[model samples]
Target: MLSIILLAVALSIDACIVAFSYSLTLNKNLIKNAFIFSFSSAFFQAFMPIVGFFIMYYFGLKFIELAKKIDHFIVFFIFLFLGIKIIKDAFKNETIQIEKNLSFKIVFSLSVATSLDALAAGVLIFSSKLDILDCIFIIFVITFVLCFMSFCIAKSIKLNIKLLQIISAIIIILIGFKILIEHTIKHI
Candidate 1:
């Protein structure tokens, strides 16, 4: 249960960052933009994990017994790689420039891009004790809430994008280490 919440929070950070970015540029139709971005983000964030879960579930089923031996390693490496990637991308200092005219296509595209990590994260769910549906609900709710709050928050204050990314990366990396250590201790 704690793992699910942590993973959801970590995964949703990307969407929140994007929402915060867009919120700065948007000057009109704030409600519509927020809804579109939030819904698109939440839907993909929730759906991609199920897709990833099924992908591993179906393809890796034959190797389940073998995989159980090294699933922790798989989860660790994936989370580590993602964490490093996020940190790396954060340092690039890429400017987010979007038109004031928001479209479903634009928001949808960004949502898909931001949620890609969640898809990769889905594989880690198999290692957890919680049900997939429970994970999905948690992810959807957290992501939606965070993104909506991000837009509201962005309107009044400036947040350090790089700082947020770095913190999120550390959380993910620590979670990876936690899982790795837990499994290693059990195996010993």
Candidate 2:
């Protein structure tokens, strides 16, 4: 349960960042724009994992026996790579430029783009003991709450986005280490 919650937080960071970033630019229709983006981000973040999970569940089943031997490594590598990627992306010069006139296309694209990591993370769900529905609910709730809060927060203060990304990366890497350690101890 704790692990699921932690993963939810890590996965939702992207949505939160998007909401915060968008909110920073939005001057009018703050409530409407925030709600649309938050819901969109949350929906994709929740849905992509199920897609990834089913993809892995069907294909990965064939490799179950072999996978068990190195599942920890796979999970760790996925998270470590994700964490590194977050940090790396934070350093890049490119930034998403959105028109003040928030459109459905832009919202959808941002939601999908930000949730891609959750797709890879869905692969890890096979290794966890928790139910997929539970994971989905937790993820959906956490993401919506965080993103909505990000919008609220952005209205009041400017945030240091790079710093937030780095922090999120650290948390993800630590979760990977936690899973690795737990698996090793269990096997031993």
Candidate 3:
């Protein structure tokens, strides 16, 4: 149980950063939009692992093994792209003032983008020796709670929005690199 909770918190760190970014753009009703993104992220994070677990348990280990490599590559590439984009935007001095309300489409898209790493995490969890259902539930709970807390902190801060975004991007990129290295070492 403790290990499951720890893993969940580690996985949710990325979602928390994303949620904080979204919060910067949402002024009024920030909590509502935060909740939407948080819940969606938590749901996907939880859902993907269970799906991976069942597929691995029922079918065979071959698929899971194949997926692990793909997941690592995808996450690494996605974070690399995002980090470059953020760095470029930082230099361009193109500031985006967060609006009071966020559109449903925007929220949904952001949720998906931020949770992509969690999808890879799901595959990793499935390949591990943990209890699948319990791990998923713990991940969902931790992600949702951490996301909410990040939103609250974002709302309270008065820092430069662009800088905050760049920091978040850097953190994500670092995590991606870490994941890639870990997986590569395991496979080798």
Higher-lDDT candidate among 1 and 3?
1
What does the lDDT read for residue 52 in candidate 2? 72
Clashes of 1: 0
Tens digits of per-residue lDDT for model 2, 9-118: 99888578657755654456877887888889889888977877887878775544454456567656756775676677677766722235557865786676567668
Evaluate all candidate structures by whole-model CA lDDT and list the values in order.
0.72, 0.72, 0.71
Q: Which sequence of candidate numbers ranks them by lDDT, best first? A: 1, 2, 3
The list of candidate 1 runs beyond 4 A from truth reads 61-101, 157-188
Greater-lDDT candidate between 2 and 3: 2
Q: Report the alpha-carbon TM-score of model 2 versus the true structure.
A: 0.62
Pick the TM-score winner. Answer: 3
Model 3 Cα shift for residue 118 (angstroms): 5.9
lDDT of 3 by residue, 1-188 (tens): 78678768877776787677656645588767778778887887787777666766677677767776676777677667766665565567455644566667555654555555565455566677777777888888888999988988988988877777567667767866876898789889
Of 2 and 3, the candidate ahead on TM-score is 3
Off by over 4 Å in 2: 61-101, 158-188
Clashing pairs in 3: none
* Per-prediction TM-score: 0.62, 0.62, 0.72
